[model samples]
Target: MAIENRNICSLYDDEKENLLLLHSAELLENISQSKEKYRKIIQAGMAQWVKGLQEGRIKLDTVADLKLLIELDIQLQKDEEI
Candidate 1:
C-alpha cells in the first residue's frame, strides 16, 4: 500500500510540473504580445505628438503627460535589454 501511494504522489508531481511548464510558456507569450502592443501604441503616440508639435497644435511645456509616456517608452527599451 505504501508503494502504491508513492507512485500516485509521483504521478501527481509529474502532472504538476507539466502544467507549470505549460503555464509558464503561456505567460511568456502573453508578455511578448503585451510588449508589442505597447510598443506600437507608444510609437504611434510619439508620432502624433511630433506632428502636433510641428503643426502648432501642442505646447511642449503644457503636456507633462506626454513626458510620462516618453519615460514609459524608455523603460520598455530597458526591459528589452533584459
Candidate 2:
C-alpha cells in the first residue's frame, strides 16, 4: 500500500510538471504573436506620422510629443533590462 501511494504521488508530480511546461509554451507563443502585431501597428503609425510631416499636417509640437514617447519607451526598456 505504501509503494502504491508513492507511485501515485510520483505520477501526480510528473503530470504537474508537464502541465506547467505546456502552459509556459502557450504563454510564450501568445506573447510572440502580440509583439508582432504591436510592431506592425507601430510601423503603420510611424508611416502616417511621416506622411503628415511631409504634407505639413503634423506640427512641430507633435514631433516633440513623438520624441517624448520614444524616450519613454527607451526608459521602459532599460528598466526591464535591469
Candidate 3:
C-alpha cells in the first residue's frame, strides 16, 4: 500500500486566503474599539485565533502572528535570564 500526502498550500488559492485575511482584519478592527464595552468580543476573537491555529483553521506559513509570538517568547526568555 502507498500513502499519499496532500499539501495545504495546494488547497487554497489567493481568493480563499483573502477571506481569511478579511476575517483577521475584522477581528483587529473589533480589537481596536473600546475594550470596556467590547471586552467579550475581543476575548472571543483571541480565543478563536488560538483555536484556529490549534485546529488548523489558520495556516502559519509566513504569518505575522506566529513571528510575533516567537519574538515575544525570545524576549521572555531573555528577561527570565536577567
TM-score of candidate 1 against the unseen true structure:
0.74
* TM, every model: 0.74, 0.66, 0.32
Model 1 Cα displacement at 66 (Å)? Answer: 3.1
- Per residue, candidate 3 scores C-alpha lDDT tens digits across 1-82 of 9865456555557756887899998976665453334444445555666788899988877367655555554554464454
In terms of lDDT, model 3 sits at: 0.62
Residue clash pairs of candidate 2: none
RMSD (CA, Å), each prediction = 4.5, 5.2, 20.7
Each model's lDDT: 0.83, 0.69, 0.62
Query: Model 3: which ten-residue window has the lowest total lDDT?
Result: 33-42
Instruction: Give the runs in model 2 whose Cα sits over 4 Å from its true position.
Output: 1-11, 68-82
Candidate 1's C-alpha runs over 4 A off are 1-10
Which scores greater on lDDT, model 2 or model 3? 2
Ranking by TM-score: 1, 2, 3
Q: Which pairs of residues collide in candidate 3? A: none
Question: 1 or 2: which has the higher TM-score?
Answer: 1
Sorted by lDDT (best first), the order is 1, 2, 3
Clashing pairs in 1: none
Best-fitting candidate, measured by lDDT?
Answer: 1
